[model samples]
Target: MKVESAIAQRISRDALISILLYVAPIALMFTTFYLTGYKPWQGSNELPFKAPGFLEDVFRNLSSWGLAAIVLGVGVIEFAVGLYENKWTKNERTLDIVCFVVPKLVVKPFVAYFGLQLMPYLLPAAKNIFEWVPFWWAFLIIAVADDLTQYWYHRIHHQLPWLWRFHRTHHSAPYMGMAMAGRQNIIYTIFFSQTYLTVALTYLGLGYAALFVKVVKSLITTGAHSSIPWDKPFYEIKWLNPIGWVLERLISTPATHYAHHADTADDGIGNYKGNFGNMFFVWDLIFGTGIITRKYPTSFGIKHYQEEEWYAQFLWPVFKSKKEGSELAANGPMVGDAVPETETVTLKQETANVAVA
Candidate 1:
């Protein structure tokens, strides 16, 4: 009886600490983006947050509501699934908040500040190139370019060892949910947000290509992390195949990204190369990343990782393991001389042939 009471107390304390840590960053973000003059433009020529009619304008506007719906929906669905599936114990969520949320919150503001404020002044020529474009074209171009950059970076995360230790936390969800989607290391977020935002800001007026991808990435990521497996029908729809083939070619698909999260190394499935894609699978298709699984992975998460406490997941660079070969995201550990066999047959791509997604 005493032990049970003590355990409960500890869990409660941990959860409290985690809550404060997670809430701080998001609250700050809401304050920052909203307080800044980043409000929506009223003109028709302006992009992002268009109101269908005047009355629809009431209820704090559809755009803000839409964003809230997406975020809350993802969180509710993820935590709900986690609760039901027992895939993530309460402790796991602790690690997730720390590992995924805190770092991003801290990192994003500074990145946004620099990208929006400081960087532009340094590159006036880039600024001119940026300002010279119409919104729609800029939107389209930025959308394509950002995804193109992400494709390579995501692929490298899978291929690299030390980096995978952190990035792989994202894929560590045993089952999917909206929250699971955001579960990643601060280092991964920094690398991604920094690079993507840098490229993104270079083309700021690209309308919502910048915002669209962020929103789309949010939706798709939540959907991808969802245990519901929307990919089944997406793959089964005969008509969707052609359209999907086009979309998946240009962006990541649930099937492809899910395989990246598959539990077993050789899950007898699609590409487990740990290469994640979103918004554009074309990068993979163009860069030899296209995998024709058509099936979501049966098993998900690292093949040989131990479940670390949640704090390690977020505060990895800090308060996490750095021991060589530790089972918990152990990097640089010798996995014996046996190299795992890969069933994937790599086909070389010819640069001469251009495939548009």
Candidate 2:
């Protein structure tokens, strides 16, 4: 019995060490950022990066509609390729359109107005405190803070059963495209923590820089969700392998993001539990939640989904699923451990798949 106890202790120690290995990169990133005095939550003493007057004017004139145009253009290309013709179901289409329209037209404007109103009251003297930070520095700070906060928000929704319902609509589609990226519950969109963070940063006088960051972020995220696999050629060419490696690590590509939308991870290329990064894949890398395979998943979406009504999927809690036993059902258990059973089974099955690969 004593020998068995010692063996168990050794195993536990080894497991803990293994976990730390995965987490070390994330810890290092946070440490480096903090040490560099790039705190997004605090005011900086350095002068902000000055841009050419014309360039600043261009950014200042950019509107939210411009960002929408970029996303819409991508959607048009996807449609031209008939990407969604056969893949998207009626329910998926409804959820995607409703989720896409409602957030941009109503929820986001409401949230932004509320945030703008509440900011001065909450932090009256703190307004424009970060105006002294340089443009490049402020951009770096906003990019990281905005994306990192979103990474956690997305990861947490997947990790917790109750929160999973709020995000389920996103993964319900069996295929991915730019449209699928907007397929989220209304509550999820409205309560997105990063939105408020972005609003606060804008209030701190980083509005122009924040606008630029938002546009860049939108491009990265939309491209990542695209079915085009634009990064595929980079992975295939021997000469571009180094660039591909760096690119994949730096931002979300179709391969990594599709893994997050994969139906199951048993295939070795699918990792629905990880790769929660939106614009930046670095967060996933740092937090030990990323899986990189320069390869896309063969299948996407949650397994055994009962195809709940679009309304229930879009406006859940306000409109519960009528389907019995569904997570979004009126009387269903919210925080139950039942969901992980499938994940456990998938992991066990993945061992054989990995060996075969």
Candidate 3:
């Protein structure tokens, strides 16, 4: 239980910058509404676009069952192509399976059911309030609100000390693929604010837009986490470089996101400390938290990873890791930032160091 680096001791100036980034979403939402001359409270809204009834059903399905099937389907393809190689051990498989299944089958449904039941009481007059907003505007607003909210949520966990372990399971994977795309700690999955935000938007009559946003976000993030590097074509093909420039900046690409999972940030291309964007890479760019090297890292996961038990990785603090000297163990350091090779200190010099990484 001897603590070396105390992450709680300090918050970097960059983290404070991240805090300021929260205003971006709020400003974007208001600006969009102002320019569009639309206000949900004014109540003279009109449906922006009318689609075939079948298309509505299709959108609904894609947002719901289609997303799960797509993740599983792409995952199977990744497995068959040896994208995981020998990295997905039994422990890794258990954690990935549980994370993928439990959240979709159990936690999300529970949250939706309860959230719907509580909505009437929570915001009695707010149900279907924004239903009249144009489809495109609603989509634009929801995209910024959900993604930016999640950007800060994600960035905070990495920069903050006490919250790192909750998100550490995600970084523990040694390789990238759909198999580990949904891998997350139970608590982290349970309290994810993005889910609640989406649900609230759906209840506020933006269900159609929310559904579309959800599908698009899921595909981008899933693809970003995939091992295939499908985006390379955009970078490699001379004709597509223009599109690639905008595309990579606009959304999470494998090149950018994989660098975020890299085991070491010392490499110019690897940036485990930044690249916190999920669906959109623009947030990283706006907040100065992203690096685009157009290169992939050689390795992934935490430098101090101890191969903690799957159960502990999935449900830590409730089930502590049995591995001694492990971060998830009953008594271990709150934030175990890896010491740089060049970092040296005399034993006599004692001071609290923040785990900035």
Best by TM-score: 3
Tens digit of lDDT per residue, candidate 2, span 1-357? 685476456545544654554455446656867798666545443225665766555434323232233234434553444335356678777777787667765665555556666788888998777666656656776777677668767876876566888888888888888777778888788888755666677677676567668768877888898878999988899999899999999999998999888887888998887898899998677657789987788887776577999999998989988898777888865632124465558877999799999
The weakest ten consecutive residues by lDDT in model 3 span 1-10
Tens digits of per-residue lDDT for model 1, 196-299: 46333533444234555555665665666666767676578887777766655555567777766776546556466634566656545544545767677777
Q: Write the per-residue lDDT of candidate 3 for residues 1-357, one digit (tens) a residue.
A: 223133333235445765556565557667878998767556623345665676555435532443334334444554454335456788888888888778766677666556656778889998777777766767777787788778877887787668888899999999898878888999988888766776677667776677678778888998899888999999999999999999999999999999999988788988887899999999788768899999999999886788899999999989999898788999877763343222325222333334332
TM-score of each: 0.64, 0.74, 0.79
TM-score ranking of the models:
3, 2, 1
In terms of lDDT, the best-performing candidate is 3
Ranking by lDDT: 3, 2, 1
Count of backbone clashes, every candidate in sequence = 15, 4, 0
Question: lDDT of each prediction vs. the true structure?
Answer: 0.53, 0.72, 0.76
CA error at residue 235 for candidate 1, angstroms:
3.5
The runs of at least 3 residues in candidate 2 whose Cα sits more than 4 Å from the true structure, single-residue gaps closed, are: 1-86, 333-357
